[model samples]
Target: MTVRDDPRIAMLSVHTSPLDQPGTGDAGGMNVYVTELSQALARRGAQVEIFTRATSSAQPTKVEVAERVLVRHVAAGPFEGLDKNDLPGQLCAFTAGVLRAEARRAVGWYDVVHTHYWLSGQVGWLAADRWDVPLVHTMHTLARVKNAALAPGDAPEPLGRIIGEEQVVEEADALVANTDAEASDLVADYHADPARVHVVAPGVDLEVFSPGTLGRPALRAALGLPADDRIVLFAGRVQPLKAPDLLVRAMGVLAERGEAVPTLVVLGGASGRPTAVRELEALAYQVGVADRLVVRPPVGREVLAQYFRAADVVAVPSHNESFGLVAAEAQATGTPVVAAAVGGLRTIVEDGVSGVLVPDHDPRTWARALADLLGDDVRRAALAAGARRASARFGWDAAAEQMLKVYELAAQVRSAR
Candidate 1:
């Protein structure tokens, strides 16, 4: 039987929108992770409820994504799009709002609570304490990860997340990590009990992202990509930290070599980062590859699949990614990837097998790798086949089954307590 047979799961994903829209600034991985995992869990006969702060006054009382998966937007304070680090004081109030939302539901609605980030961990812990439910926590990104990304002098946050994260690691029934790297980081940095942590990699929607579904020529035609030109696609928000400029610079090197083929297609919209667009445009002009660059506005899932299918390759040049949904999605579409060798991308993209991983900051090295991969159709075909094979292992069905194991463990521990 699935954990939903117990009919009690409350997911706390505050500070990020539901899977419907990728939130600004933070990684889109968390929102996708929660949504896909919850849906997967529900498919296994589990009742799952996801909670996020309502962004609009006209939103429905509850959004039913599936038969057993429901998303509830609890009423919180103003300023709809505030980042997590800026939402600490508002969490307690949000927690109260969640409790009120729950009160309106039937009794025994939630027996176990799982929270996404540290802020949501605090809120979930509060609800868990009051409702006497077991709390399971996932720290999608840690403070140390933030420290590694920031400069020596610039403080990312003054209050910090160590204390609240420590509480979740120590008190929550169990802590789940999306990768072994994250699990080890939790134990080493926060002194989280090694016995209390588990690693479950995130899953991709294989059904929707399958290869034959793309129809490359049609998709390319739809996107205005030339039939003869190779296409390099990049999706996700336009942000400095994402290192989008790195991709533009890499393409510039390819252009300088007179080997630039297949227009570089950028997906996703600017997230209040006006400078990022100017930086990319300036870099395109600097490289003299402006004519070969195409920036497609934000696209929904259907259009995104077309871009993935139409592309010769997808590039994920993140400075840090806890788990790479971009790489996974590209693989699911039977396309090869060129990614930065960091975080979860390292785990997803095998160096020469599934796709290519280049050094994090070296644009020339990235350029060489991209050129080599895109130029050799034989290698590209092999990588494409391998990527599709590797992606098959990450079906949401399997991921959801594994998550139920975590839920079962949490419930067993809670029952013992």
Candidate 2:
């Protein structure tokens, strides 16, 4: 059987399950990336079996998330209360489960193994070596890249993670990056072989996140948001890396300037820390913009699209992102994004076109950008139109096609070795 003709894939996402809700605990864009990409590959005739650590006991051993796609929950340690930092210790147990599952099947059951994140890469390294299949890894976020742009009071990624990522980069037959910048980082920072690194941009679900039929005013009314008030939306985990606190401070800057402070709607939950969301609220209160701040839990994609449509502009002030999924999704919904100029976000948002790109995380700078964009309806409309066009460059089908090619290359590399 040819690689293009329905290759069976063993996909590993060790830290976060595809079925978990994003914007909460451990789950984020990486979860969405895996879930959506798997379905896209399945639609293209690939049979994908995703292995994720079981987070809850109630979860079945295997679940069919989409036709031709199965999510296998491997029990490694305690289902709950295991922090992400502790996951490295459970790699041996998780690897055992993956090998046992594949052992039950015939030899050569999986054509290739694709893993997301460094933790999964550790497991994939073993599984791929045992099965004699090519290993393809996507480092959703690199420890070095994140540590270089660490937010205030945020801890640097542990040394263990950095070592694990470097090892994975060395061993993997193919390394997938969400942007060219990331691919360059792999080569320059991690000293990865340039020939093995591939750039396959993650895609947005345009069908679910498209511009709706109703106008912003109508959408706001439907969402129970005040129609007359200007709205700025922040959708992601309330974590230091995401820089939601920067948005609150920007709101404070706007208020202090006696400008019309747009309601800053934060749509996400705490991540890493249990009190993250509450702390964000406290910051908003201290900034004297608490009344203008609204915190909402992250919702499903369909409902999230509604929230995107209801806002005048979407703010993505992340300190770093491998790929800014929220910015891409908002642009797909015809909402202009004001995102920080960092990592993949620099590629996702087009400055003065689809959205404005802030060069720094300064609250006053963000306030000025937000104020100027919100005050000018003509510019906002122009950007909204450009946002849709810019977002068109990314699609799941296109991403899947590119990924299939990468898989084929990985297979060839493994065979030659």
Candidate 3:
């Protein structure tokens, strides 16, 4: 395989619009990653095109983000958004739209087809084979790893979504994992060729998430928190997998002992999975810490920054995250995080440095970690400062440069084939 001239890359994000609203089904991290990566790649002299389903009627057919980066909406299903589990049936139609659109292009065809999520891999695999382009897949979540880490209730039940994911891993030419854990899962569960898997971590926008700009006073007033109240926050989709109940249970433990319990703010929206709002509310009531819990819907990125800034500490107690983008965002905002030591969170937050990593599924441990951070001002300040320094390692510019290397490698492989 040899490197060649300027490459045109087609990024398949088939289920959700690359430019769609965040926190929606399959639209949070993957949407951010694809949109950010494509734009950054364009800035670095690559002709990039993002292909996604037209999930909204208001979505334009073609969106030009930069001179070299474009988002072309492929007609599939209807205007309403579909879950990734049901996306395979729509990929054939999406492929047809992509083929038609590319036929009218004046320049080079897609030298590399990069896919985000399993559904996109299904389409990319077919397109790569049909057009003789190299196929690169980014499995935002793996069914094998996710199924093993499922909450006690969600496990034991057959997950239809796992079937589609398995098909993608079995077919794709290359797998781009966000962490070593995901890379291990792909090889262990699906027997993917080890040579074809690449570990490329996700990146955060350092410019937007820089320090000292968050308006904490205004944000605290909006959330109705007292100036003196210690606030520990969790921000992400309000789904069962996110384990908001665990945070409520941990808060309950602090309340039971008559210790100083920090105000627990759960900021997120009802994205894909069944909303766990009632379960979280029930846990709060059962734990007798209803007054300490705050459940609010998603806020804008600026307000989100304020929440991150105002927090005494942030918590991400997910059962498992493929890549903990929230942890990175929190760290970027100079907020200390108390996350479960699992998945990509291991890489994002250094234990006892940027934040504390509690054992997964252990409410007592979570409570202790939360209590430790809330109790010690000096320690919290140190962690916060460390987070600011550590977050610089995940700059989007460096991430985009790494992706260019991957694209070039994929293009060289495609040319050889």
Name the lDDT value of residue 217 in candidate 2.
81
TM-score of 1: 0.92
Model 1: how far residue 412 lies from native, Å: 3.2
Model 2 C-alpha lDDT versus the unseen true structure? 0.94
Q: Model 2: clashing residue pairs?
A: none
Who is ahead in lDDT, 2 or 3?
2
Give RMSD to native, each candidate. Answer: 2.5, 1.0, 2.4
Mark the regions of model 3 whose C-alpha exceeds 4 Å error after superposition: 1-6, 155-167, 213-219, 222-224, 272-275, 415-417
Best by TM-score: 2
- Scored by lDDT, model 1 comes in at 0.79
Local accuracy of candidate 3 as per-residue lDDT tens digits, 94-199: 8898888878876446678889877788778778777776778898887778777886566432465567667776666567888888888888888887876888
Hey, what RMSD does candidate 2 come out at?
1.0
In model 1, pairs of residues that clash are 4-46, 230-262
lDDT of 3 at 355: 94
